[model samples]
Target: MVAREKLNQLKEKFGGAVQRADMPCNERLFVFVEASALKAVCQYLFRDLDARYVISIGMDDRPFSGKFMVAHDFAFDQDHLLCSVLTHLPADNPKVDSISDVVPAANWAEREIRDLVGIEPVGHRYLKRLVLPDGWPDGVHPLRKDFAWNQVPEGYDDTREFKFDEPPEGCTVVPFGPFHPTLDEPAHFRLYIEGEMVRGCEYRGFMVHRGIEKLAESVLTYNEIPMMAERICGICGCVHNVAYAQAVESAAAIKPPPRAEYIRTIMLEIERLHSHLLWVGLACHIVGFDTLFMQSWRIREPLMWIAEKISGNRKTYALCVIGGVRWDITAEVKGELRKVLDKLESEWTPVVAAVSKDKNIQKRTRGIGVADRALVKNAGLVGPVARSAGVNMDCRRDHPYAAYDRLDFDVITENGCDVWSRVLVRAKEVFESIKIIRQCLEKMEDGPLQLTIKDELPVGRIGLSSVEAPRGESHHFVITGENNRPRRWRVRAPTYQNLQAIPAMIKDQQLADMTISLGSIDPCFSCTDRMETIDLKSGATKVWTQEELLKLTRTKKT
Candidate 1:
């Protein structure tokens, strides 16, 4: 009913522009609008109706529909509705009005659409290549149906270099990474510094683009993608695994058993526990407080062990299938999980007490790397980043996927809107994750682990899923297709949006604060780089083919 109400509101304002609409369920709404009206409808939803901008997706639909498609997703959190606005463009020259001006959060997503799918976002200023390499040939969008997944453009030029922006007057440019000690992945940030204060930055990342989405659409099957999805981010693999599975299930109108939902929730929370603990430890380590860092990690070890006991791996759980989960929490594993959680809560309470009052840690983080409520809203930052700024949004509570609707837990919030606030928020959330897992253990009922599918999934159906990862909301968009794999699968990790706010967050801060400031978002560069290769000795560079890489991996194992 809420979805219908929102749809009615859109239809009332722009009758003919809203070409068609679908309400897959009470929680989801899909509206197909005229290509000309895409920006206006998005502006109305985002500015007037106050929907939260989620992500934008570009699709090459020429083979099936003889048209290109672009979709912009938004969330009506309080209304518990996820809505998508889609438009079809002419196949020959696919282009649509850009919504970046109105919805500032869509800036990178729009650029990504242009880079991967060749859908031009007309009137978009500052359109540089976002996802593709600097040397990638133009007019060769790999996401198109005709483009082979393994095909390299004929004019591929690895020797080409990226062009960065000029530094502000009186500011000196300083390169931060691609290999900084604080960063675990490869992301390069060129910071403009005036004395000790940071003026602005230019970020050039995606050094290891995995091309997982292309692989899913072109190669992997429906059930097989869950395994591959887990590798999207080393830290939040299960989050992706579950989110991908849920997206497919949603498109097909299939629901897993109640027990499976609980299992998913439990695994997700277990992941939260380890992730929060790891973040807190790393945050302390970044601030030069190794005592707390060591203590936090020592307390976190058992959670990993318990996770390994429940599933097979500590990090990549490989837990979800299309309709349900791969692993169930038996009574033995459930009891062990409870004991681990109990110990974690007890150990974490004292650390929180100590950190809350520690003047040194407070001095370092307080009022540093600040992202106020306005930045959170404008940039579409989610999870702890948004909550730290006093924006009361948690996908588990707001969107209510899996067993979240049946469970009870608090959505933590803080007003500091700084690195200190984020530390406190994540530290305190550990107890909440403990609470959620306990509830799952007690309330979980005995049922089948998966739903049985009798026939092929209906084609051309679109599904969107948002799972609250420890760092932020992990969103997945799936369009069902004929070959038992997705026609298109787009993953918008929280980092994709959260990292965009980095330049703003670190701006005007001391140069020394950059590491902690960037760390506060808990950015997973791999997730953003979802769209890799190499050479050695002779200094001759050659992009390794998948076959060569697999052979190397096999040789190493042998």
Candidate 2:
């Protein structure tokens, strides 16, 4: 929300500590704040300056600093724009005072830092093990450069210590996922059902902790890492890849040409459209509306076809490179994309009307999974989930990235703050994405897509890139130079942050509605692949390991 001029004023206020400010096609000013003032600066941004804390990224330092560095990113709604205020924290004894006091949403990001980087955000009320097992070693942060692979430290234990137990009276807790019949991604949730009503809930995940950051530091070059990181989340492939590429470009102080920008935007919107359509199908399934679900996915096939034709893969498109993009949209390809768009635009009205008027859908999703605006804001919800709850926050419209500034679209908002509203927001966004794509097609001109750059990048360089993925904002941080590969890279999938609000939204809803509500969040468990069962009355917990379950099932079969 910070204007160009106001950002300049803020930069002037900080002077030297504010290193290398650039607005990057997006309205956001990538300001590198000094470590000393991170907490205070975040407080100022949230309280007096209208910005709210989004999330944090921790990365390894290359030459200038120590083993790692951290950036606490913030966004605001002053002019309904998404701008960032980044604070850099040194890796040695990397400690920054927690801003949860000013911005409650910092809690999960702080927990992530605790789990992955071993950096303690001082004053975080609940800094227990999150995303990692409790028995995981203290100093062996997975995101750090020093973490040893293929070997556990001496005397290290594999067991985790769970903190919660025992549901309240009248509450019947149901443990759904790390793996579930309905879920496509792995994440665990304990739903407290009071009869049919959900009194409260708890979330636990991160089973698929592949050490992507550490892996990027170890094996891949800068150009290669984007392809590698794109696999971080199967659904949001373009988001992660594009953000990572942008981060590296920023660190290297290079900009992709105008043609590349337009291509990136087109890809981004196409991905967004595809993701939302998939969510629509999932939501319909949750309500047992198979016909609608089939229709939604059937409509979605063309989008996937386009992704395959353009990027050569349906899921993990290796389309992005460090300097810019790996491929360009040709005249024939552009014409084909336009044809697909025309089909999509024509279907929009009928789909929206059918979803809106369906009595069965109304019965299940109308008032289910309601979360208060304050609750959502405090949890730091992002993307469609936040916007559905009347948050009025969209990283694309608020933070103009790629070709967003040159293109036009509305930041769709819904004040309903319920499952139905969230569905509506996504449905509306499908139209807006089509609108943006049409504009891009109309205005796109011929030029070079990827700019040529030297193999070696500048040393001690750091860059941050955030794009509005289908679900929400996907953030990437790159740390490395001369090597043209990041010494350390942090990838924050939107599901990493938005999962916090799942508990808040499903509370007091019915057991069946809980299923519907879960679908509303459009979950992608980027780090986790499984679930844990907890005692409803006593909170006693037990993780049903996959191998154990398989063994038990085999014995029964025998």
Candidate 3:
């Protein structure tokens, strides 16, 4: 009765879009709310009930409903796992109110949503395209159901003629990517700066939109989509696959064997280790520590090798499938993992010590993008970014899935709430992940890795699954019970949550600090791009194009 009362309060406060509520196999109950109530519920969950923002995601809902869904994963005590606040908005309109006002971490999430899903966040102070080309079409949202796969929009082939030289008066706009020098991927950013500080910004992406969501609907079966989804992000591929499979399983109401759960957790932690290592390297590079970046990546080689050895592919390992995992680590591989963990533990000490003690790194990172605790909670941030801001949230610890509940590790947090704190949190989490892998190795029991789930999905059922990705939270929403595949599939990556907090973080920071501040969110632009609009009423124009405006000063010497 006492437990029920607590759950009831949560339901009462955030009820409108609460879709499905359930206790896990354990007795603790959690309710799923709408994305509209995300900020309110997160506040209720945290300030009032002491819950934490575990993670959030924005998924592409293709075909059937043709809507994009936002899922915010939250948690309370160790026992209770709040499923998510799941809300769906039209793929055409795509826009939703920005939650950054409430949770600072959401800045990046909103940016990515604009970048990938073409969602125009109403009132989002920094609604720039994050990951796509500079001259993407105005009304063609990429993740929408109707976006043509084979044909590129007419003007996309020749966007070189549409560059803008100077931004409007008092609004300092600077273009970022879509093939600039900053990043490997084709994500673009146009910063609106006020002197040395950033006033607001925009992000663009989707230069390489493979139409994975649309392809998933046409080509893949329910079982095959898991492997297909694994290719979404090369770094966090496994999490995408696992979360999608789990969502399918939840919709079907089928649980994998206990041993399979243990194996899944092991893979997840291994992936976590490699991801953190990769990010550490990137973080180093961002601060001009190329040697450290290379060294960290070198250490990550063993984990990648092990992943290939076990799952056949080095990057996109199709280890996870619906109903169960596709591969299992043999005793030999298990032994090798333990050896790798031991090696990483020994090697990481000096590496981390070097970074932590470096005066240069300290100068570059310390106090450089501070998001206070109030901003964090209000924005409802997630993952290490939130943890760095004193939000002790980790999906593995809070909303335990797979064998996370069985494993033991602390959710690392730091009060520093700066770029330095974020780096520290991720570094500590790598160690915690190592501990988890060791536990899984010791406790492994021989069992079948695969389960036979029917190809067809049942009708009228919706299942949401959330996983802590390297950046933050990745969510999969499956609304399909009929036919061979999901009728509606929505996938939300962590960038969706982190993108929202950018404007808040970069407001007063120097322009140079903008790079580091953006990196603090740990964004992924696998598929994001710029989108522009012209205000019909005012006749003032806002268009995202690379078109070069005529410079009056550069005009013929009159």
Candidate 4:
């Protein structure tokens, strides 16, 4: 009943117009609807059914189907259902009604599709450049099949600066970045400032949009993309790696061994531990509490050692392969891991207590950067950003992946809906990560680490996976193709959605507090710059150590 009940409802509502449908599992549905009725169906699914909008994907289906494809993904969190309503329009008239009005979270997605795939979203309120760089040529959609990954078309203009919308009445302009001290990546934000208060802001980002999806679609093999995916972000590299591997596994119907699942879980949680610590310390540093920042990094240094000992690296462990994990936890490493967890827990408990009660930290963060429940729904923000706002949605629990279904950690949420609550949520989640790793260790069973597949993966099979990254949910979609590559690979980084909510979060807030506000979301511009989905293969990487970062911070302050 869980499988077909909702699919039946969609069929019953749309009748003959609901052209075709497929169910990948009991919890996932793919329905093909007529392009003309897409907006109506989207409204029905989003408003009437109360489904949460996930992401929208546009593809050039002309090579195969002589039409353009649009997929609006949604998750029914309560029902444990993930659905994609796919519609195809004729190549000559590639236009579909926009559902941004009905589901506000779909706004950036709609514009993104328009930018990359050349499909127009009719009635879109602001169809500005969302993904492409400032000087990209018009009518040259990069995601189209004919466009080569390395091709720069004729008539390209590299110096055409983006003209942002006019400021509100009596508001002075304050440019934040296309380079910021707090951000490791570049994104330009023009703030409409009235004295010290911010009235509005316009974002012009995607400065580093790399054609990774095109690379995957054109070049890489099935098992080789996991390493590339890890390059999405230094912080949540494993999340993307795991998400990409799981997507391929889903498409090929491959289930890794139980021990491999446990190993994957361990690596993911290890990443969460380091990433949360990094975020908390940065949040403190942003609020002028550099002492805590240094202290947190001091406590976090050992995890790097533990990770290097296990995976031969401090970060980008390259732990994921197509069917299973690349590394295993040995008895000696398990002993060391247990000791590390013990020390992490003991050292972290007091710090959590101190931050929770500290007046300066509380005053600096408590009411700044608020994202209420309404904004969470409208912007599709995930992870700590949404959870702190009383939105109890965790991909590990709601849409279980890897060994998460076998784990018993709680999804930490708070009702404060501010930077303070976000701090509490992440700080508490470190313990939860510790608990999950401990459980994985205890439940370990000696077995093979990966599956042996005798045949190539089937062509044209579709797969999708969502992993809970430290910042939020990192989602990947894949369509298997010939030459051992994906036909279309789409990535929706959590930052893409969460960053869109920044304008709303900072509105009417003090200009002085904006950095902490942005820092609270743990914005990873490199992750957001992932223009399309690409499977990342595990490989060598260079990561910033705590000492290096500390020196950099001190240098900046001086």
TM-score of 4: 0.94
Task: Name the candidate, 1 or 4, with the larger TM-score value.
Answer: 1
Per-residue lDDT of 229-269 in model 4, one digit per residue for the tens? 88878888999999999988888789999999999999999
Candidate 3 per-residue lDDT, tens place, 1-558, comes to 434665678767666555666654442344556657656775565567765554445656645456677655555545454445556777566667776655545566566566656666667776655444555565555554456434466555333333543554697777666675447676667788778877766544455555666556444678788877877787788888888888878777778877788878887777888989988888888878899889999999898888888888777777777777777888898888788888989999898887888889878888888888776666656677878988766767656779887888888889998999999989888888888888888887777777765545567566667788877777676766455777556676776556656767887678898778778777776622112221112213422221234454467886
Instruction: In angstroms, give how far residue 554 of model 3 lies from its true place.
Output: 42
* lDDT (10s digit) by residue, model 2, range 316-363: 878778657777788898889999988987876798887798888878
Rate residue 503 of model 3 by lDDT: 65
Q: Arrange candidates, best TM-score first.
A: 1, 4, 2, 3
C-alpha local distance difference test of each model: 0.92, 0.73, 0.70, 0.88
Any runs in candidate 2 off by more than 4 Å, and if so which? Answer: 1-37, 59-69, 77-94, 149-151, 159-163, 527-558
Stretches off by above 4 angstroms in model 3 are 1-7, 10-79, 83-171, 527-558
Better of 2 and 3 by TM-score: 2
- Stretches of candidate 1 off by over 4 Å are 532-558
- Hey, what RMSD does candidate 2 come out at? 5.5
Which has the greatest TM-score?
1
Error of 2 at 226 (Å): 1.2
